[model samples]
Structures are given as structure tokens and as C-alpha cells.
Target: MKEKVGKQSLKFENAPYIIGAASVAGPKEIDGPMARYFDRVSEDPTFGKDSWEEGESEMVRQAVMLAIQKAGVNKDDIRYVFAGDLLGQLIASTFGIKDMEIPVFGLYGACSTCGEALSLAAMTVAAGYADNVVAEASSHYGSAEKQFRFPLEYGNQRPLSATWTVTGSGAFVVSDRESEVCIKGITTGRIVDYGVKDSLNMGACMAPAAADVIYQNLQDFDIEPTYYDRIITGDLGKVGKKILTDLLKMNQVDISDNHMDCGIEIFDNEEQDTHSGGSGCGCSATVLAGYILKKVSSGEWKRVLFVPTGALLSTVSFNEGQTIPGVAHAVVIEHHEMSKGK
Candidate 1:
């Protein structure tokens, strides 16, 4: 008789898995001939304007509600809600989930909020502490520009590396059931400061942080490039993505075509003229929630690694001449075979 290796177990007794995800946009609220200018003050003439004010919590709420509905779960069933935005104090996320009646945990990871929130949500379900959890992030051009770039009337010229703020929101629900989509693993980034001089260019500021975490993740998991189907980076934009590629190569890791950046993929970089490309909480969130999740569900890919990049800097801090610190959180999403058809 063949020797039995310990007891073979097919069942995975984890907390739960990611069942569904959804991303909602306010119909491209601000778009026009002069929308490129940061100082042009014009109301976002859109349908959801009443509830979707710039930098308001309503947008986040709408996205979360839609995610809950898509997951086929009631809001009351969610044990925990992890949400965040770039706005001060994360007011958008807090107020958005207020009516859900679930325990809400606020977070601020700049553009990386989505990944951070998702990691926490996955942990909650994986640890058996929550049956269902939600992670969400939102950002609006009008509000983000005013807070980070310039006032409506300032009319300041943007630098070549500056990124545009995306107006949208994305959310996901994790539960205790086998599903087509699942969270495989996550690597949290350590706060890194390289003493960069330029604050306006976020790519240069956050590249080091992304590199450190990505390296650490590879080291910890002992995973090779061929092991994963895709390695996606959050909002590092074109400039930062290039830097990261070179850095990874130095460590004998080669990720070329399989590597993608949410900032560059979200919009038509050439046509949209988004400077270095899109960078914001919504950039990665919307792309993953709307596009990637659907593709994963369709069985096009088996394993995916998501690294959301964040530039931990504020206008107040920048004005005070403080160096910008950066962080990135890596989350692995995969398909669970046993949970299929359940």
C-alpha cells in the first residue's frame, strides 16, 4: 500500500472569501473642454450631483450599497465595514456607511486606501471574526483638486508629472463561502522616507516604499515571477512603474508584460492627457472592482497580486516643508476550487 502522507484534507477552514465586488462612478461628473485646468470652477453637471457632491460621503455610500446588493447579501449581515478616502478625517467613508448599521473602521492610506481596506476585510473574514465584510474607497476631482492641487480660482499650472484625480468609487464584499474570487495573501508596507525634495511629483516619492514592500513580500512568500499570473501595482503611475521595474530586476525578479499599474490602466493615457496618468483612491479601486474582479470571475486568470501604492502626504504637511512618506499594501486574490458551485 502507498504510504499516506498525514491525513489528506480538502476542506479549508478559513474565515470566508470574497464573493462579489462593484465599482460605481458618478457618470464622469467633470468632463468638458476646460476640465483640464485645475482652477476652472464649474459644478460637476451630473445626474448624481445631488447626492454625489465633490468629496462628500454619499458617493462612497452608493458604491458600497451597490456592492452589497451585487454580493446578494443584506447590509445588516455585514459584520465589519472597512472604508477610506483621501479627504480629511476620512469623512466620506464614515458618513457613507453610517446607515449600514455595521461596525465601520476608518482608514487613511492616500491612494492605497482600497488595498489597505481590502486586506483588513479579508483578515476579518479569514480570522473567523466576521462572516461578511466590505472594503471601499472614493475620490472626486473637484474636491481632491481643491484640497491637494489648488483652489478653484487659483489657476495654478500643473507640473508634467502631476496626476489627475479620478471621480469614482469601488467596493468589495468578503464572506464565509467558496467563490470564484478570493484573497490569497497580503504584504503590508512599512513607512519609508527617502528625503525626496519634490513634493508635487508623487511617483518619485512613493517608488521606494513600493519597492521595499514588494521585495519583502517576495522574500517572505518565497514566490517566483512564474508563480503568479499577474502582478498589478496600484497608483504608481507611469514614472513610478518604470522605477519599480528596474528595482525589481536588480533583485533577479523580472516582471514585464505581466506587470500592470492601475494608474496607467484606468484611462487612455495618450488620449486623456492625464499627465503621468491617473492617481487617487478611485484609480485602483475602480479598476479592480469594476474590471479585474469581473475578469477573475470569468476564469481568465487564476492568481493575481494587487499592490496599492500610497503617498502619505497632505497639503498642510507639504506646505510645512515636510518630506513625503509612502507605503504600499499587497493583497493576493485567487480562485478557490472547493468553493466552486457553492
Candidate 2:
């Protein structure tokens, strides 16, 4: 019942079931390789909204409602909703879910907000504080570009390492109710800065944090790369995936074959001119909801180590020339096949 693991990890005694999940992506993402998996796609990024910010909020709104609907539950069934976004004040989430009337825990972990929310939601359910909880996170290319970097009008040339901010939202219904997949444990990450200052290069900034959290999770659980069928990292893109691989290999933990980056899987590198790949809260959120859990449910993977990485920086910090600090949280998800083995 203690559930406490090593310093930064927790072992849940009663793992919460991931009852349902839904993802909404923009037109660009709909054209990607994982498009078929997404529950819904917005033909236009605006979704007929007045502003891109409002459009981003609408994405979150639709995603949460779809997730709730897919779970066959009403809004009243959800005890709490943990959601977040890359917007300045998390307005994407606040304005989006305010109508749900569910008590909210608005989170901010940059791109890692999805993992943060999921971990917290699972904790709430495991602690018997809530029967049903919804964890949602979103990002919009237009909204994030306006807030974090130059507008499209600026037409600034992007560096090869630059990643596209995905316009999408994903929501998950986690509960004590029975489901095909469940969260077994969680490893909370610490903020780590390697003096990365390039705002355009998020993969470089976030990789170190992903490595740190994954290594800690492995040590805490005393497991090797072979333990999980897949070791997935969120939004690390192509460059960050290399960095994370190198860091883990240096620690004598080789996970090259089993490791998969949501950023890398979400797009086709050669065909899609996404540069390094996808990056944003939506990058991992939609991938997890749309693809990762699907694999679990289908028994394509018996167990998975899911770690969502984040670059914790703001417009003010970037403008002030502060280094970008990275953070990542690890969540252990298991299939019933592995449940019996464990």
C-alpha cells in the first residue's frame, strides 16, 4: 500500500485502468503516417473558431468530450479533470474544459504535461480519492508559434534541428474500472539543464531530461531493456532520440532496439518535411492515446515504459537568454499478458 519506490518513483498497489482515450489532430498531422489512428482530425486548424487560440481550446474540448463519450460515461461521472497546454496561462485547457464543470488540476510541464497529468490522475484514483478521472493535454502549431517563437508571417528560416509544433489534443479516461491496459508505476523527473540555449532546438534541450528519468526508472525497478517490449519517449524527435540513446548507452543500458520516440513515429522523415520531427504537448499526448495504448490493447506489446520529455522554458526566459531546462516523467503501462506473468 505504501507504493513508494526509489527516490523519484512510485509503485502503485492498485494500478488504475486506462478506460478510454481519444485524440484530435490538425490537417497537417492528419496527413502524417499515424493519421489513421487518431480518433478525429480537424480539416482546418481553426476548427471554425475566431482565433487560433480559441481553435486550440476547441481541440481540447472536442478531444475530452470524445474520450468521455468513447468511455460511455457522462461528464458527471468524472470526478476530476487534469489538463494543461503550452499557452501562456494554460488558457487552452481552462477555456476548453470549464464547461465540463469537473474539478481541475491545471498542469504545466511544457511538452511533458501529458505525462504529468496522467501520473497525477493515476495517483488520485489509486488513493481512492476519485473513481473516474480524465487526463488531457494539447498544443497548437499556430498558438505555440505565436507564444514561443516567431509568427509564420515572420518567415524565419528554421534550423535543421528545429521541430514542428503539432496542432493536436489527446484525452485519457483513467479509473478503477476494468480496462485492457493499466498504469503500474510512475517516475517523476527532476529539472535538468545542460546549458542548452537554442530556443528553436527543443530536442537538444529535452533529451537530457528524458535520459535522466529513464535511467532512474530502470535503476529503481531493477529492470533491464529486455523487461519492457517497448521503451517510448515523448517528443524527443530524431535528434533527441540519438541523444537519449547515447546517454543511456553510456550508463551501460542499451535500449536501441526497444526504444521508440513518439516524435519519430508520428511522422515520415523523408516524405514529411517536419525537419527533426514533432515537438509539443500534443506530440506525445496524441501519440500515446492514438497509438501506444492501442498497441497495448491489441497485445502487440506486453509492457511499455512511457516517458514524456519537456523543455521547461517560457517566452520571457527565452527572450532573457536563459538556458532551457528539461524534464521528463516516466509511466509504466502493462498489458494483461504481462500482468499474469508478473
Candidate 3:
């Protein structure tokens, strides 16, 4: 009956099923490999809005509404919405869902907001606090560049290490209703700093945190790396992917065989000319909603360790020459059949 597992983890006795999920992506993403999997795609980067920020809000709104509709649930039936975006004051999310009138919890874990939101949603539903809830995260490439790096108008040359921020939003309807996939457990991560101050190179900043959490999850569950069919990371791109595997290998926990990075999967580095890859909250969120869940639901991948990594840094902190610390949260997602016998 004990839900508390090991340090920094929880085993839910009543795992919440993901009744519905949706992904809304932008123009550039529409050309990517996973484009066909997205529920909604727009050729306009502004999403018919005047500004990039407003467009991002529209994406969030569309995603949440679509997810609710897919779940076949009335908006009033949902008890809470855990959502966020990579914007100051969470303006994107606030404006996006304010009119919905659902109780809301705005979260910010940089690009890892999706994982954080999902983890909290699972915990809340597992505790019998609510019958249904929505967890979503969004990020806009134009908005992110305006806030973090230089403006698109500046026409600055990005380094090869730089990653393109995804312009999209993903939402999930987590409820007590039985479904094809569910959240089994979670392993929360702590902020870890390697003192790397490169604002452009997020892979270097986040790989350490991803490695730490994945290692802890394996140890806490007393299982090997192969316990999950695939070990997924948020936005570690190519450079960070190498660093993550190398770090885990040092601990004798190798996930190289099944390791997959959302950043790497979202875009084709060569044709898209996206430099390293995609990096943003939407990167992992959309991938999970559009692609990963399908595989799990089809029983192609029975279980997956979804770890979304975040580089904790603001323009203010980066301008002050602060190191970009990283954090990652891991959610155990499995097929319903896998949990049936247990």
C-alpha cells in the first residue's frame, strides 16, 4: 500500500490513464519527419496571431481543446489543468486557458515543463483528488529566440551547438478512466550544475541532469536499463545525447541500446539545417503526444522512461554570467496490458 518508493520517487497504486493526447505544431515542424503524426499543423508561424507569443497561446488552446474532445469528456468534468510555457510570468499559458475556467496550476521547468506537468497530474489523480485533469506544455521558436537569444531580425549566425526551439504545444487528458497507456511512477530530479556557461549550447547544460535522473530511476526501481523498452530524453540533441550515454556508462548503467532523444527525433539535422536539433518544452511534449504514446499504445514498446531535461537559465541569469544548471524529471509510462497482471 506504500506509494513512496525510493528517494525522490513515487509508485502510484492507482496509476492514471492517459485517456487522450494531442499535438499542435507549426510550419517548420510540419516539414519534419514526425510531421505526419501531429494532430494539427499550421503553415503560418504566427498561427494567425499578430505576435509570436499570441500564436503560442493559440497553440496551447487548440491542443487542450483537442485533447479534451478526444477524451470524450466535458470541460466541466475536468478538475484541474497543469500547464506551462517558456515565457515570463507564464503569459502564454495564462492567456491560453484563462477562459476555460478550470482550476489551474502554472508550472515552469524551462523545457522540461511537460514532464513536470505530467508527473504532478499523475500524482494528483492517483491520490483520488480528481477524476480527470489536463497536463500540457508549449514553446514557440520565435518567442523563445526573442527572450533567450537574439531576435530573428538580428540575423545572427548560430553556432553548430545551437538548437532550434520548437513552435508547438502538446496536451494530455489524464483521468481515472481505463485506457491503452498509463503513468506507472515517477522519479523527480534535482538541479545539477556543471558550471558550463555557454548560453547557446543547451545540450552541454542539460545532459548532466538527464544522466543523474536516469541513473537514479534505474537504481530506485532496482532494475537495469533494459527494464523499459526505450529510454527517452527531452531535448538533449546529438551533442548532449553523447554526453548522457557517456556519463551513464561511467556509472555502469548503459542505456545506449534503447536511448532516444526527442530533440534528435523531431527534426532532420541535415535537410532542416536545424544545427544540433530541436530544444524546447514543445519538443518532448509534442513527440510524446504524437509519436511515443502510439508506440506504447500499440504494444510495440511496452514500457518507456520519459525524462524531459531542462536547462535552468533566464536572460537575466545568463547576462549576469551565471552557469546554466539542469534538471530532469522521469515518468514511467507503460501499456495497460503490462500493468494488468500486476
Selected candidate, larger lDDT, 1 vs 2: 2
- Find the 10 residues in a row with the least total lDDT in model 1: 1-10
What is the Å distance of residue 140 in model 1 from its true position?
Answer: 1.3
lDDT of 1 by residue, 181-272 (tens): 87866777788888875656888788788887777766767678666677888878888888888888888878776888877876566667
List ranges where model 3 is wrong by over 4 Å: 338-342
User: Compared with the true structure, what per-residue lDDT tens digits does model 3 show for residues 1-342?
Assistant: 588888988889999999999999999999899899999999998889999999999999999999999999999999999999999999999999999999999999999899999999999999999999999999999999998999799999989999999998999999998999999999999999999999889999999999999999988889999999999999999989999999999999889999999999999989999988998999999999999999999999999999999999999999998999999999999988743642
By lDDT, rank the candidates, best first: 3, 2, 1
In terms of lDDT, the best-performing candidate is 3
Note the Cα lDDT for every prediction shown. 0.74, 0.91, 0.95
RMSD of 3: 1.7
Q: Pick the winner on TM-score between candidates 1 and 2.
A: 2
- Winner of 2 and 3 under TM-score: 3
TM-score of each: 0.88, 0.97, 0.98
- Among all windows of 10 consecutive residues in model 3, the one with the lowest summed lDDT is 333-342
True-structure RMSD for candidate 1:
6.3
Ranking by TM-score: 3, 2, 1
